[model samples]
Target: MKSNPNFLFPKLASTIEELRQLSISEERKKVLRPLVLYIQRCVQESKTCNLNFICTHNSRRSQFGQIWAKVASEYFGISANCFSGGMEVTAFNERAVESLKRSGFKISSKGKGNPIYAVSFSENSDPIVCFSKLYDDRVNHVENFAAVMTCDHAEENCPFIPGAEVRIPLHYKDPKEFDGTDLEEKKYDERSMQIASEMFHVFSEAEKQG
Candidate 1:
């Protein structure tokens, strides 16, 4: 990992600046504390943090968690690898993709049914490869990684992840409920920004620990 990740594209940087202004509730901060400590441990040990964000479908909230966590790690100059997965395979939701684009992410995708998206926040950093698969997919770290459950369903269904060093429940509300409605874009953007803000908080706390 780059010691100091490259500067984000101007638009993305602006979006992140906006996210930084959002306030996280104390209750929510309590829920996020475990993740903060997990990253702090990695920082203290000089270990590369591997985060696997898991949800039921691996389409919406989980993807946001994966993307924002990676961005936050980079912003804080933390060595981290972020991944997202689900209990069942599905395509990354298009609405979520559009919301990310609105936030200034540069994405290119290929394949038919389940296109793989290459998502980038900075010009020099390699794009994060995103698609839907199980949490234990070969592409993800096999052990010594944090299994961050991003949805209630995944946390309930997956009681044990064989290789995970810690399982943290950092659940997020699904924006999929607003799909096909006038509020679709609004809700997706809200959830995406919410996740982005929270991830930034987590990394910021970890950086403070260092």
Candidate 2:
């Protein structure tokens, strides 16, 4: 990975440390380590790595993966691109946006009828481009990218991704089950934070190796 003189290593390290304090399953740690190491290899080789996080609804887990990947890439001084899509077309959920905002992401909504939300990692960084679309449509022409399955349904249903060099399954539980309860928002926020924290931890380890 190319080194940046302005890279904020201390801040990134602290962020990862804080995130690691949150709970993560042992099963998840196993999958996350290899996946992150793969990303580190791609970055080290100076390959233009493109990542697609897939799910059934393209609303929750996949979205979180996409955002966290982008943020982690920036944090590690890696140049990588991240995208997310689902098997079915669905608008971005408001709860997801709110959860990200609560976790230090800046989100701006524009357009109409479930408009695409522009998400930025930090105030000065370029915003990550986000929209609701099917996985195939989103990655129709892209080749040589990593396809990460963030939901079990998507991973099982779509066995083959035409252009993906590496296919990794990183399933996450849907927080939607807790919707409409007193813990609805809290659950969503917790889910978002969990994804963010784990991703941060994984990338921080990769950075250390470099």
Candidate 3:
């Protein structure tokens, strides 16, 4: 695969290896198939492939999904826009931010409770701007995008996301369950890698087929 400079960062480089090592399960593929097809269709039609990942809190999984998806798309040279939002606004947890740093994203933040983070996966590529906000927040694309539910709570609660051309359920186990425990870091990194793996699979598959 032609590599992107951001993906080549030593910290993120290990993550690329981890993602490559993962074998996408059939169950996971079931969720990803529709997303891949949707992205491919967008490309074929010359439309923007925007993806917005949603969760109840938007502190963790949704944030990871959005960042990794954008990074993977850049790696594979797909022109996809990715974002994350929650049903309720919460600060993007520091723990979650720590996990991303551990995964090799160079991160910086401003503000206190609701800090906006500039997360860089590579030097040559644009950083993924991250924060927690409502799904309908002005920062997110309101139209011609897919609503990807990263948590079951969000998928079940938000049955009617307006302006979403497609809705895809790509749930992940919340690592927040282990927060404040000894395994918190492990669980967070595990969740991050899982999302990174799937995103790599999605973008890689789209590139192959398109």
Clashes per model (N, Cα, C within 3 A): 0, 0, 1
lDDT of 3 by residue, 1-210 (tens): 354644457868876887779888897798799999988887777666999999999999999999988988888877888999999999898998998888888999999989999998777777889999999899999998999999999999888999899899999999989988999999998888889999888888887787
Q: Can you tell me which runs of candidate 1 are displaced by over 4 Å?
A: 1-6
Off by over 4 Å in 3: 1-7
Which candidate should be chosen as best, given lDDT against the real structure?
A: 1
lDDT of candidate 2 over 15-53, digit per residue (tens): 545776887778878888777777778767877567888
**Which residue window of length 10 is worst by lDDT in model 1?**
1-10
Task: Give per-model TM-scores.
Answer: 0.97, 0.87, 0.95
Q: Quote the positional error of residue 199 for candidate 3 in Å.
A: 0.5
Per-residue error (Å), model 2, residue 125: 0.8
TM-score of 3: 0.95
Query: What is the C-alpha lDDT profile of model 1 across 1-210, one tens digit per residue?
Result: 223434998899989889999999999999999999999999999999999999999999999999999999999899999998999999999999999999999999999788999998998899999998888899988899999999999998889998899999998889989999999999999999999999999999999886
Give the TM-score (vs. native) of candidate 2.
0.87
| lDDT by candidate, in order shown | 0.92, 0.77, 0.88
- Residue 86 of model 2 has an lDDT of 84
